[model samples]
Target: MAQNNSAFSDSSVHVDVKDYYGKRLQKTADLKTGACIAPAQPLPAFIRDALKKVHPEVTARYYGCGLVVPECLEGCRILDLGSGSGRDCYMLSSLVGEKGHVTGIDMTEAQLELARKYMDYHMKEFGYKEPNVRFVQGYIEALVEAGLEKNSFDIIISNCVVNLSPDKKKVLEEAYSVLKDGGEVYFSDIYCNGRLTEEIKSHKVLWGECLGGALWWKDLLQLAEQVGFSQPRLVTASIPTIDDKELQDLLGDFKFVSATYRLFKVPRGNTKSCKVMYNGGITGAEDVFQFDCHYTFKANEAVEVDGEAASILTHSRFAEDFTFQPPGGSCEPCNKPKVSVLLHTSDCYDCVVLS
Candidate 1:
């Protein structure tokens, strides 16, 4: 069972979120803090072009913290948790092509109504013979109850919304339950330096703004392990500036950053280190494929990888994109630890997993 916060029940948090996102927030400009704003980074040309095709209204209402698009999305089924305004869903709909499908789930009826209203427009704009995206009204913590089948999605992506949930562990558990073996959950959201006080968690406005219920970055590591997913690989990170004086005062020494992470659901085994080379087939990444912050594989160049990374590349959807040499077959022995401890410093822009 999912545990709720002592200060607020699950139902109360849901109500507060619905009221804030549905009734109070009229547009992206209505956001009081930078926590929900998209990360400031240059996107690839392909992604920029896809964003251009989305309806202006959908883009205008987007409140996500970072870009959730992952590589090799050509024919995969995707699920967007808290798909507000369906911005990421619509963008993904184009990337997934006509043969693939995308599902957007949200708790607020108003957001779902808005997301559903533009289905026809996006399909026509993408030149698809049929619509490839759909929206569901449900909580992220209870995906099975919302009718999403087990092992149904190839990838699940959420943006800036998980922090708003009262039970973060339940959300991860549900995500793991719904993904196929070797599938992944690639998401971006707010993370604080440490666990917050009850007073901070009890603040309605702070909670609604995606500040109050933020997770301590370390807790995410334990949660992923508990839910049977691979250790999270940090993809990108950037500090979010809190401009509100009152909120800043309330959060005296605590700091926040919008970070993206990728966790895989691969078969459990003691994978050995191997040398792998990219074949250069993924659409946008024809020359180099960056698996995470630590490893980047250039086309046709054999790069040695650790055991965990070796497992992810071998078992996930990216398997066909690379050629792997058998472990110990002319490959250097890997001396790194199996578990990489993530270390976050107060002044650093991003956290790194130290092997």
Candidate 2:
């Protein structure tokens, strides 16, 4: 229900929103991404591995607001949303190995062209005989229409692009449908802690730029469930601090968090029951923290953190999103993990339930 007043200026019908900034060209960032692009420059360990096989141009032109690569990508079909210049795709190409396939999808023509041009060079650089990469010109929401088969991909990855879609709900549904029974969706995109009202989301420039169009974290979790995904776990988040007092005044409490989330689409998670494991004080915690908690479980449940039992429900089956909390114990805080409800058949295996 937001109309694009900034980009289109038509101000007539309320459009879902394609982009707030405008149509993407060859560049990775625009007005919408703003300072978010700065995060990519640091390049996490996972990101470094992904960039190793890509060309300098690819890295230079890359515009991602989140980290998408984790260690679980072996022999998996990886899909990169808004895969500009095929940077992330090529990174996955090597990680998935020769047996796997990496598909990069973006609506930008110039970016894809550059990506295609470097195909041969990347294949050689990564030591692959026949590059296991492909690029398709399509919007993130139109992936199924782009000739992609259903229930196919093993891992679906997107870096700060999903927020640009006009139809966020539709995108989530399509994503869930495409993953294999035990597959996953590991992505990093901008998510606002509070609501993104119709006014802000309607701004064509913001939507196109991939800001003010972010899904509310709470709404995202609900959508994941509505579309059949478990609770999403936070992999890594860069908390915005007031290191610079001036920047804090302009931004307020609003912070940018680039988290790698995992959602398993299989029924295996339901079988997991509650069990307590005590690893003592947080594995590497410099301070002690108390968590108010509760929970129990059935049988065959495979989720239990070696550290604190209270946070077992927070462990993500997807290798990347798993983060440790309080030390394992039999206290009330150790009852059950949050959103640890594993669904039965007709769904995913390692999917996390984001509360």
Candidate 3:
């Protein structure tokens, strides 16, 4: 595995994160900035019900920026990167069910201990014959070294934890290596308008708060391309407020948003545009399947999709959920309005309007 040789050592960053989440912060209430907490939104009924079953102790320690749940999760093997307190892992356990499995990996021992402490409790609560979830102690940037097989997981999720890594590129690389060809890294993390200075990056409090280590939003595009993943699809975003006056002044003009994006590991090539209709079998999104900020497929309605979207629909786990037809013959692309590009320069903190 490649290590980041910068003014700050990778080991030092790991130590700081462990100290912050393990010793300094006792619960979500102990967090200094709102960047780690996701903004409120109406969730699907099934998701809301699943969350209510998670252990209160585990939910209390959750500090994620946004919900990382993706559709078509019935029997898919999933991995959770930086699965602090196992909050997501336990919730996902119910979604994946008895046949599917969820593995959570976190570096902090204290968090891991708490996660394992409830293993039997959650299994009984979910009424499972046996436990389908397991917790591993490992770093996100070094998953292969941590004993995870390459091309193994159907999906991987991270919530507000990617920014804490000193080498964000390494983290993406590791995630790409572990995912199956049709798999995806669906995650939510803190993103800033522009890159921060080294002075801000060095601040332990700022980094721990998930502000200083945030990636410049544009940089994520380049990183995904470099890592050989499909273009990131923006799902949702919200502005995170820094309430502390001292921290706000220290941040100056820099702005941060909690954003969720999904990057797929599909074949690298251009696929022709096609007409697709959702069959609508996925749980929670029965009537309409919202693919991203730009695309929403109503059940049985044939909509023309771009090459990238077509490829994702046909090649991934969702292939079974939709039917596809070639564009421009019987399908006729002109019948429906083409997807529009929404400009979001003014609402930088709310969402990224993809072109």
Cα shift from native, residue 308, model 3 (Å): 0.8
Ranking by TM-score: 3, 1, 2
Q: If both were scored by TM-score, which would come out higher, candidate 2 or candidate 3?
A: 3
Candidate 3: tens digits of C-alpha lDDT, residues 1-355: 6875532234898999999999999999999889999652468889989999999999999999988999989788999999999999999999999999999999999999999999999999999999999999889998987889999999999999999999999999999999999998999999888889998899999999999899988888899989999888887787787899999888888878888889999976679988887888789888877777668777777888778888988889999998888875564333342232452322433434221
* 149: Cα error in model 2, Å: 0.8
Question: How well does each candidate superpose onto the true structure, as a TM-score?
Answer: 0.91, 0.67, 0.93
Q: After superposition, how far is residue 278 of candidate 1 from its true place, in Å?
A: 1.3
lDDT of 3 at 52: 95
Q: Tens digits of per-residue lDDT for model 1 on 196-256?
A: 9999999988998898989988899889889999888877777787899999999988888
- All candidates' lDDT scores? 0.86, 0.58, 0.87
Q: Which prediction has the highest TM-score against the true structure?
A: 3
Runs in model 3 lying further than 4 Å from the true structure: 1-10, 332-355
Error of 1 at 355 (Å): 20
Global local distance difference test of model 2: 0.58
TM-score of 1: 0.91
Badly placed stretches (over 4 Å) of model 1 are 1-10, 330-355
